[model samples]
Target: MSSYDFVVIGSGPAGRRAAIQAAKLKKSVLVIDDRGSVGGVSVHTGTIPSKTLRESVLNLTGWRERQFYNRRSTDNPQTNCAALNSRLSKTLLHEVDILEQQFARNNVHTLQGRATFVDKNTLRVERREADRTAVELVTAERVLVTVGTKPFRPDNIPFNNRTVLDSDAIVSDLTIPKSLTVIGAGVIGIEYATIFSALDVPVTLVEPRDSFLDFVDREVISNFTQQLLDRGMSIRLGCSAESIVLDENDWPVVTLSDGRVVRSEMLLFAAGRKGATDDLGLENLSLEADHRGRLEVNPKTMQTKVDNIYAAGDVIGFPSLASTSMEQGRIAACHAFNAPMPDAPHHFPYGIYAVPEISTIGYSEEEAKAKGLLFECGVARLRETSRGHIMGLQSGILKCLFELKTGKLLGVHVVGEGATELVHVGQAVLNLGGGIDFFMENTFNYPTLAEAYKIAALDAWNRMAHERSGKVIKLKKRKVGKKAA
Candidate 1:
């Protein structure tokens, strides 16, 4: 039987990262996955595929041309799905190949098989290839289970290959509908809506909520809503598809909960994702999943009920991005080895790949109030910055929250160009326990979006001054007056 110091199941972001981290520490590692390829959903269905399509749409359809030059001015403004798919596929495959090479360089053994828990210290690995064979495997003392999530498909929906599709199916070029109906206004839904809409395919987005992106700041969502509307996308919030039927033309006809009937060439259910822990004999190990089939991991160490078996990524659920999952995987591996590692970052960024991106780190405004902390909000619109003006940014905003009493930076939220990139500044500040004073004193590049952090800090300082009572004002002046003044 093959053996290693560490065996990571599922070669996704979390598993791959965990293996790499362990390998870096001179641990023999084996990474097993069911898929024939590497890089997991991030490379295949989720991050790379979507972002590549977004970029392809922007370039081919001249969406970015509309920034400085109008689409009408482009020699060829129309885009085709085949072209976007061809490019996206090529790039995605190259990325997966590179990741495979990296694993090889690190001497991490990748086994193409399905792994099942024989016991806490043993696994039964069924190898799948030209000559299939079952092999009894002995598990390592430390195991990292980073099996990610899969797109949730509900039984109520009639999901025929032609008329209805899931997120994974859309990655293939087979069903590029002329007009599409997308359910769920969460990140995936909004992203697909924007992508298809950008391709000039009429898209109708339905959500069973009063607002889109409710988790994000309201102003940011409003701006995104405006952008999507401008692109000729239809949004129906507080409405859900009661039933879906295929027309004689093999198109999808959906009846909403509000008694509204909508027809589309295709229907995409981006409802959400569920953990990938269903079939790995989790029950045998006495591990249980919640309603969403996600493991309840210790937020501190990411260990499941069984201390030796650690879970990370979407399997554990929430903040389920490739970047965060990578970090969690590395941390889990470190914890498994009992390696001396620094504390996890206090603030982690959340990125939603909608038309206009949304990203945030740290506490939300409501969370601050719920915690009964004295806080102030600072806001800056992208239009207010010269960089935004030069880039033709029509709508985008950055909001910062700070602890009023101690001047500690609480949160940073943004929706606009480079929202994901801009969140790092806030992350650094939050990690260091830096406050509004740090932002106000620092000088950012001229006419840059990063200036929003400074502007937001000043805004918070002004509000803190206004909200403080006489006694509080004296305390603030005595401590932070030099910086604010």
Candidate 2:
């Protein structure tokens, strides 16, 4: 029998970060995950692989140069699969190696096995070694369940790992289809659909809803939706696949609720994901997950109904980005150990690694209205930036929303090249409660896309003044750390 101060189940972003945080506080930490599954979905199937594939597609297809050169690099037969997978394989290995090193450096013990709850405080790990299996029971004062999630495969989908696939299977099994049809307009579905379209593959996106990405500002979505249309990607909304059957060529033929028949060489169902908690033995603790297999937890502390049990990551649902999950894990571990920690974040950034990329922080325009807050929207197109021209970008925008009366920065939204990286500057300003004045007054590098913030702020400044409210006060820049000259 082995015991530890903190026993983290799953070695994904959440579990790994929580275990390390506890270890730093001098607690005995053990992280349990299935054999060879250290990096979880993020590294293996979700975030890393998808982003790498996007990068590979861009490079091979000369996507970045298409605007300026108007000519693409010659297509290589190997690019269909070999070229993309080669880089992905190398990247995954390096990422896992670094994760293992972090564990070893922090003295965070990791056990390879399927972990199950023996009780609220005890866990049974069934370890498989070659032809034999070993079972071990471990006890901990606090236990964290962060097993993450798996793709939701419907019984009727008829996935064959060839003509039909799920988001998880596509990470390794995907070959550039002659024509691809993706069901679902959620982040994962849009990402894969756009990625293949970037390679000049004919991609048709089918969603049951009339609109998708409802959390994003409508203007941003309009821009993104237009981009997809311009790229020859077909979108079917307000309907669902009534039935999917294989044709004479073994291709997927999908009939929609609207009486539309769509046939594609391949179909990808990325409608949703379910929590990987079914086999976790949560019933022993009288814990139940929602219909989607998501756990209910105190958002403040990430604690489950059971006092000593906590859950984080996708298992708990919403804002399931690996970035947020890491922070949640850290917070959960600190609270479990009664360690002093920073207050919860004011907001978190959402990045969708699609063709052009979309990122947002804080309240979106729709959210602001729903909350009954008055806000002003300021927008700047990337084409106005010299950097955009240098990079041959034809479309991109940075939008800022300010509290109408006080000029307080309420949100930032962007859709374009490098939008994910660009949103951080806005995130910092929003977190500090900085307003439009900060953007107008701050000195950003010349000829950079960041200048869009200034352009946008000035636009909002004009509007705020039009309302004849909120005086712009000149403030001095304070150098906090450096010695004065």
Instruction: Please report the candidate that would top TM-score against the real structure.
Output: 2
lDDT of each: 0.82, 0.90
RMSD values for the candidates in order, in angstroms, are 3.4, 3.9
Segments in model 2 whose C-alpha atoms lie over 4 Å from true places: 469-485
Deviation (Å) of 467 in candidate 1: 5.9
Task: Report the lDDT tens digits of candidate 2 across residue range 94-151.
Answer: 9899999999999999999999998999998999989999999999999999999999
The per-residue C-alpha lDDT of model 1 at residue 75 equals 32
* Candidate 1 structure quality by residue, lDDT tens digits, 1-485: 77788889888889888999999989999888877787777887888888888877767767655777766322332346567768987998899888889999999988878888877767788876577676758578778888788889889888876679888888766446769999998889888888778777889999998877666766567777887888789899999889998889988999999999999999999999998778888878898898888988887888989988898987888888888899889989898887877887767888887667789888888777888987889998887777888888788889998877777888899987889899999999899888876777666788789987877776776777766666452332323322234
Candidate 2 lDDT score relative to the true structure: 0.90
Q: In angstroms, give how far residue 374 of model 2 lies from its true place.
A: 2.6
- Residue pairs in clash, model 1: none
Task: List the pairs of residues colliding in candidate 2.
Answer: none
